[model samples]
Target: MADCVCVVSEFRAGNFRRVSFEVASEGRRVADALGLPLYGIAVGSGVSDKAEELGFYGVDKVFVADDAALEHYVAETYVPVMAEIIQGLNPAAILLPASVDGKDLSARLAARLQAGLAQDCTEVVCENGVLKAKRPIFAGKCLAWCEWSQGALPMISCRPNVMDCKAADASRKAAVEKVDAAVPEARSRALSVDLDTSGKVELTEAEIIVSGGRGMKGPENFTILEELARELGAAVGASRAAVDAGWRPHSDQVGQTGKVVNPNLYIAVGISGAIQHLAGMGSSKFIVAVNKDPEAPIFSKADFGVVEDLFNFVPVFTEEVRVLKSTC
Candidate 1:
C-alpha cells in the first residue's frame, strides 16, 4: 500500500485557488515527514494546464481527470470519480480546503471510504507515524486535537488562511498522469455557474477587507465603503445586521452565522461588534474599528479605534486613502 500524502487541487475560472496552493505546500511538509512522495489530483475540463502548475508548489506527480462532465462542481459527479481515485491510490492521508465545495466532497468521500475525518483543521502534525489535526471548537474559543486510529486513512479539510501560502518555484518539475476515471450517470447537472461579478477580491481570499454595518444607514451609503475598499484593493463586507435588514446580500455578510474571514487587515466601519461577528473575523492579523460609541464592544477587540460619526469620518478617510494611493 502506498503511504504518500494526497492533495486535491481546486480551481476557479481555470486558475488554481489560493487554498489549493496552500494545501499543496502543507501536504508536501506532511509527505516529507512521512518519508513519502506528495501527490496532487486535479479534476475538471481543460485542467491539464492548471494541473501542471501544482508542480511549482512541490507536487512530485499529478493525476489529471479532464472531462467535460467535470467542468462544474456538482457533488453527484465529483464524489464518484474522487472515490475511484482514492480507492486506487489508498493514500495515508488526503488534504482538501474547507470551502463549501471542499466540505461537501470531503464529507461524502469519507463516508464512502469509511475514513476518519477532521474538519476545518488549522494545523496538521505528525506524531509516532500518525497524523494529528488541530481544529477550533466552540466558535473558535478553544482548540481540539484529533488523530486517526492506527492504519486508518485520514481525511482532513483545512480552513482557509490558516497556513502561510508557500511561494511557487518555476524550477520544480513533476510527472503528469492522465487518469481515465469512470464518471457515473448523474441525476443532476450544473448547466452553468453564475459567478460573482463584483470585480472585488473574494472575502475569504482577500488580504485586506473593509466592512460596513447597520450604522451605514442604508444600502446607498455602502458606496462610500466600496470606494474605500477600491482604494485599498480590498474586499467589501457587511455585518449580519446589515444583511438581515436587506441592506446587503447574504454573500457579503461576515459572522458566525455567515462566512468566516481571516485577513491581514480588517477595518470595521460603524460596526458594533457582536460576539457572532467577532467569531468570524477575530482571527485577523489586525483589526480597526470605527464607531461613534466609545464603549462599543468592537473597540475592545480592535487594535485601533475611532469614536466619530461614520458619515463625517468615512468621507475624510476615503479621501486620505485616495491621496495615499496616488502617491504610491
Candidate 2:
C-alpha cells in the first residue's frame, strides 16, 4: 500500500461544512507536492451519497462510514472509527478542519495513534516529503512552524477561513468505498443540544462580518448593526466588552476569550480594538474600522478607517448599502 494524504470531511446538520473543502484543497496541495494520492474520509449518517462532492476539490477517493449511530458527532464512537480507518490506510499524513467537532476528534485520534498533531494551523506544506505546518501562538501574536518526527505520523487541523478553497469542478467525481461504521458503545451521550436558530450566518464560516463594541451603547442598538449585516449578507459579531456589558450574547463575542474569526472582510463599528479583540480578527483579509475617536486602536489595524460617530454613520451607511443592493 502506498502512502497517501487523507482529509477527514466535516459534516453537520445534514450539510458538509465549508472547512471540509478547504481542508481537502490543502490536502491536495500537500499530496501533489509529495507525489501521493489525496483521499478523504467521510463519517456521518447517510454521508455516503454526499461523499463524492469532495472530488470536486481534488480528492481522488473517499472512504465513507455511514451509520445511524454516527449521525451526531460522538467522540467516543468517532475517534475509534477514525483511528481504525487511519491505521488501516497508514497514510503519510492526516488533515482535518479545526472546527468544534473536528478539533475534538483530531486531538483524540492523535493521542490514539501517538502521532504529532498540529491544531488550528494557518498554513501547511510538504517539504522534502515531510509535512510542515504553521500555527498561531501566544494568542495569535506570532506563528510557529511545526514538523512531525521521522517515525511519527503527521496530523494537522487547518483553521477555518485561513486556507484557500479552490474553485470546484462539478464534473469531477471520486471513487467511493463503503466501510462499516463499527460503532462501539459510547461512555456518555448528549441529553439535548440547544441550537441557535436565529438564521444568522455562522461567524467563523462567514465571508464577511460586521462587528460592534461598547460604542453601540446597549442591546437595542445592535439593531442597526444587524441591519447592515443583513444588507451585506454577513454575520454580526460583538467584542468582549459588548458581551460583558450584556449588549450581546456570548455567542456573538469575537476575541481571544470568545471566537476567532477570519473573514474576507471585517467591519468594526464602534470597536476600540483591544489586543484581545484584534487577536480574534487580526487574520481577516481586510478590515474597516468606524469610530468617533481618532486614536482608537482599531484604526491602526484597519485597511480603511473612518473617524465618525457610529450612531450617526451606521444608519446612513445601512441605507446606502440597501440602495446599492437594490440597484444590483
Candidate 3:
C-alpha cells in the first residue's frame, strides 16, 4: 500500500472554491484511515501563499508546481505534472473535484498513470486496507462501489457542492516541495470560458432553488418565478422543457444531462419532476412544490404541496417571504 493521499487543488482567477477545501479534508480522512500522510498539489503560476492553507486542513506536505507556462489550464500542461508527481511520490490515492475542469484532468491523469478512477463520487473510504468509493450511475438509478484490482493509486473525482468543507485549524504547517515543471504548449487551447450571465444565484452553491417548467406557460411568464426567486435569494433553475423551449439557458437546467444540485430547499413551480429530473435534486434537504396537478410526480417528493396556479399564487408567497426576511 502507498503511504500518502494527494488532493489536486485548482485556482480560478486566483481564488479557490469550497470543493478544494472539502477534497483536502477528505484526503486527510482517507490518509488517517490508511495510516498514510495526506499531501496537497496546488498548481498555478504563483500560488505559494495559497499552499499554506492546505496545511491547516491536515496536509502533511504541500507540493507546489509553479511555472509561467502553467498560468492557464492546458490539459497537456497539468496532466504531465500531476503524473510526474504521482509517479515520484507514489501516493496511494489522489482526489480531485468532478467540476467541469476537474473531470477533464482527472480522467486524463488516470489513463496516463494506468490507474483506476471512480468519478462523481459521493463517498470514499478505506476499509480493512481497501479503498472503496461509492458513486451513482445509470443517471442515479443504480449505485456502484469501486476498489482497484491491482492497487494502482485510486484517482477519484468528487462532485462539487456534494462534500462539506471541513473546519480548519489555521495553525498547522506543511513541508512544501517544488519541482521543475514545463508547460507543453497545446496546438489548440480554450477559445473562451463563457459562463451564462445570471442575475440569479449560482445554482450549485445556492441554499434555495426555484425551478419552473411547461406549466409556467411561456418565457415572458418566467418573471413570476424570477420575482419569487429574487425575494427568497434563491437560484433560478428550469426543467428540460423550459430549457428546450429556450426560456432558460441549458446551464440552468437541472436534470441528468444538466447539473445535479442538492440544496437546502428546492421549490418546484409547475415542474412534473421526471425521474431523470428528480435524480438531480432528489438529495435536496427539503422540497416544496406548487403544481396545479395534485397527482404530479413532483408532489410525491415535496415536503409541502400547493395545488394552485403559480401565476395567481406567487405574489402572496413573495409578500410573505419578504415580510419574514424583514422581521428577521
| Candidate with best lDDT | 2
Q: Could you give me the TM-score of model 1 versus the true structure? A: 0.95
**Clashing pairs in model 1?**
none
Evaluated against the true structure, the overall lDDT of model 3 is 0.84
Tens digits of per-residue lDDT for model 1 on 1-328?
6657899988767887899999998898889888889999888888887687898888999888889888888888888888887677768899999887898888998898888999988899987667899988777778899988877889999888877677988788667998899877889998789998867699998899999999999999999999888888999999999999999999989988888888999999989999899988888889999999999999999999999999999889989988888898
Against the true structure, what is each candidate's TM-score?
0.95, 0.96, 0.92
Q: Candidate 3, after superposition: displacement of residue 209 in Å? A: 1.7
Q: Worst lDDT window (10 residues) for model 3? A: 191-200
lDDT computed for candidate 2: 0.91
Which 10 residues in a row give candidate 1 its minimum summed lDDT? 81-90
For all the candidates, what are their Cα RMSDs to the real structure?
A: 1.5, 1.4, 2.1
